[model samples]
Target chain A: MLVARGVTVAIKGKTLLQDVDLSLSPGQVLAIVGPNGAGKSTLLKAMTGERKTTGGEIELDGRALWHWTTAALASRRAVLAQSTEVVFPFLVSEIVTLGIRRNLTAAEQYRLVQRALVAVDMSTMSDRVYGTLSGGEKQRVQLGRVLAQVWSHGCTYLMLDEPTSSLDLSHQLLILRLAREHALSGGGVLMILHDLNLASMAADEIVALKDGNRIASGAPVDVMTDDLIAALYGVRVQVRGVPDGPFLLPQTARLPG
Target chain B: MSAGGVAMPAGTGAASARRGGLMLAAGAVLLVAAIVAALAIGPIFIAPADILAILADAAHGIRPTEGIAMRDAVVVLDIRLPRTILTALVGATLAVAGAVLQGVFRNPLADPGLVGVSTGAAFAAVLWIVFGGMVGAFLPQAVLAFALPISAFLGSLISTVLLYSLATREGRTSVAMLLFAGIALGALAAAGTGLVIFVASDQQLREFTFWTLGSTGGASWFKIGIALPFFAALFVGSFWLARGLDALAIGEAEAFHLGVDTQWLKRLAIVLVAAGVGAAVAVAGVIGFVGLVVPHLLRLSAGPMHDRLLIGCALAGGALLLLSDIVARTVAVPAEVPIGVVTAIIGAPYFLYLVHRNRAALGG
Candidate 1:
């Protein structure tokens, strides 16, 4: 399990998050939902030790995160940022093989990279140059790489920040389902998702943030309500629950007298 | 799946670009052959037959026909061999340095000499030159001999550290910042060097000017000996780093998250660049753009893998520089042109064209 206690963070003299307490246990999918500039990414960074915590600490297995070396931390959790751009061109398999750097044998690394590509449905394009791929294709490949990293070292926590922003609807759903599958297979995923419907559908738990404060946190069914959505977004939104998932559509705003 | 091209993954909207392996192999073989031609051609125009005789005799202790003087053998083995080998060494070092820096910063415009490393070396070399001469009367002769290149190497290290620090933010090196800082510091160090030259006595000024112009005019066996091993070490280091560099090719953060240790990789790149730039300029002074041109040429055929690109760049760079050295000697006969002049004349226009074509690619 991963836990953050009173994790306050500030960058460049500006507070990004305040006393944020978050935890991810095994088999949990916690979807962080918030608008732009709501510190979702910063919170993710804090948890991942990518950004320093101004106050408090993150604990993994009851030990403070700072004590772990970079390699140790990397071996523990996997992180995927919004976008990655390559300067030189590399083959997809060669690129994915880096996910297991210094940890796996050469042959084992190659096999894992191949498996990752296959898992992401990118096995056919293993020899493709990474630079020549389009945005959506790159996203899938990056997803494959991230999965490769997680699988290579057996990270319990997978942190993804807007991983589906550049993806089409189908790939988005595929990735979310993959994350769910990953969680079901004895791993945990913490994803920052902008789409509330996606969060309500895929997330077992939802943590909603607004202006650096946690507005609510609970099971998606209990926390996702029409009144909460209207207040959080400053607009009216109707929520309909279907067997497949929750669907949300924005409606005209109405102010209280 | 593409016959000659890499197919795109699920989301990328277009087909992947694939450079043919045959083309890459042909290019590498062609470059190796070019290196041989470079070894063959020079001011005296040693015929291939005579060249073989000279080498075979040296290797197997088989003397040439009675008509061929010991002077010819001495000239070939002593004079031409050192200069040609030094040319190849300096060329490989600079080109490999450039290629590594490009990967380190993720900038296509990176060139070792152009990016302040040589200027830093020059600053140190010039300072030591002036100071040693000032203290020559009192100091032991041993102190004077070792001072110049040692200072130069130190200067290179300092400049790299500064450039790296200036370009880094929150533990990440920004390519745009690196380029800007490099250019700015390069200009500053170069200007400082020019000022030092301006104030130097005419005789010493001539030496400094000629050093900057760069030549294989005064070939020495010692310089070649020093450069050879350094270049070899750097070549091996670069080749070993091929996979890590490939990881960085996709971007720094991803590479870091994937456990490639981005900062360490960059630091290693800088150290390699330092070693190469230090040894090359110390041995041959500042030769422009071998670093830039050879990598671009190699990239055309090597498919941008640092593994292939490293070896290809080394061979091509060695060949290109040696050929340029040959041309510089032959074009002017007894009054040889600076090899640097030849490389600059060839590389500058191509560099300009690349800049124009990839204007958008080099942006922030």
Candidate 2:
């Protein structure tokens, strides 16, 4: 279990997230849905111990997050944040290998990395310099990195903040599909997505945020009501349900300035 | 230049033990070549074999043959030896420190000395030189020479702490912020050093100017003794950090979730950078661009894994500075060029060449 209670985060006197409580359970994929700047990323960070909680506490597997060493936490949980900011060029294989550093040995580690690369279908680009790759290519390599992390340390909790932002349509589906399969394998995934339709198709549960609060959360079909999205985004939205998932449509009904 | 078998998912053989062995052998060869080249080009032109004999005798303080001449002995041991050793020490230290700082900030262009570490050292050394002259009657020259490096070290330590505190935001350092803070602190330190030089008497001004120009004209065996341990520590520490740095290259939040103590790694890096860059400038003064140029060049040639980059940076830096020192001492025959000038003259063009050739890579 991954849980955060009454977590508050303020950056430079601007309170981005306030008193958010969340839990990500085993074999469940939680899609954090919200408009831009609604603290979806901040909420994920607070839960994962990336952002310091000003008020309450966080726990993973019934122990306080503070209790686990950072390395231990890494093996237990995995994350794929936004774009990396590395000054030096790095190879894709080198980047993926870092994900397996703490848990696996040389032989097993390489095998796991190769497997992770294959999962993302990026096995052929492993030796390419990460900087030399295109944005989508780099994103897949990063996914491969985290995939290696989870594969080596089985059943790890996973969080991804906008993992699909730089990806193309095919790779995006490939990545989200992989995350869902990972959940099926007993690993948990919490993803913050701006694409509500993508979330509807991919996530088992949807948690919606507005102005730093967990305003809505439940099964996708239940939480993605037209009333809720219109209220959340302040833009009229039409919610459609399909056999596979819910589809959120940007409504033509603009209610004046 | 060998992109090493364009196959992706490079099998075990790609980063295998063989590649590591090859890099190590290349490093060793380059180092030996640097040593031989540096020892060979002085006014007397001693052969590599004779240079080894000179080394063996110098170990026991034995005199060389009379045919080798008193002038040559003084030239090799007192002049060239000190300069060469000091250059190697300072170069290796700066490159390792640069590697750590760049990784800590996750900025490829972040250089340790670029952020005011060296100027801080320079500032402290200036303060000592300007004020300590008043106590010449009380303090022995040996003690004064020894104290300068300490003051420089303290200066580096203070500036590093300040830079770290200011650059850090939400427990992570942004490279742009760190770079700005470094420039600000560097300017401030430079102004402080300038103030001291501006107010001092004419002769004192010349001394301050020469010191900042960076040289090893006054290096002794004792200073080498003091430098070796820090170099070794930094060398070992750099290898340990290579993995952490590799993790950090993919964003701190991801690295943190991967189990790296991003905060602790950053703090440890700041301290290491302070000690390494401080001790370096203390011994040999400010040698610019060796840190910046060496790593970029290594990355360009060897590919950019910290495993390769760190070792390549250290060995290449050691060789580069040693070669520059040789040029400094021999280029003008009897009159010596400041080692700093040699590095600057060589490094600036090399930097320009990299920028010119890799304009797209540097993105202007």
- List per-prediction Cα lDDT, in the order shown: 0.76, 0.76
Correct interface contacts retained, every candidate:
0.36, 0.63
Predicted structure with the largest TM-score when compared to the true one: 1
lDDT of 1 at A215: 86
- Compose the digit string of candidate 1's lDDT tens values, residues A1-257: 89988888887788899888899998999999987888999999888877788997899878898887777887888888887876655677656666765646545665677788887778888777788888888888888888988887888889999888888888889889889998999899999999887888889899998888788999887777877787677766667777766667655345444
Off by over 4 Å in 1: A102-110, A243-246, A251-257, B1-28, B60-69, B133-146, B167-180, B201-209, B228-233, B361-364
Work out the TM-score per prediction.
0.88, 0.87
What is the C-alpha lDDT profile of model 2 across A126-212, one tens digit per residue? 767677888888878888888888877763688888989988899889989998898988888999888888888899899898888
List the DockQ of the predictions in order.
Answer: 0.41, 0.46
Predict model 2's lDDT versus the native: 0.76
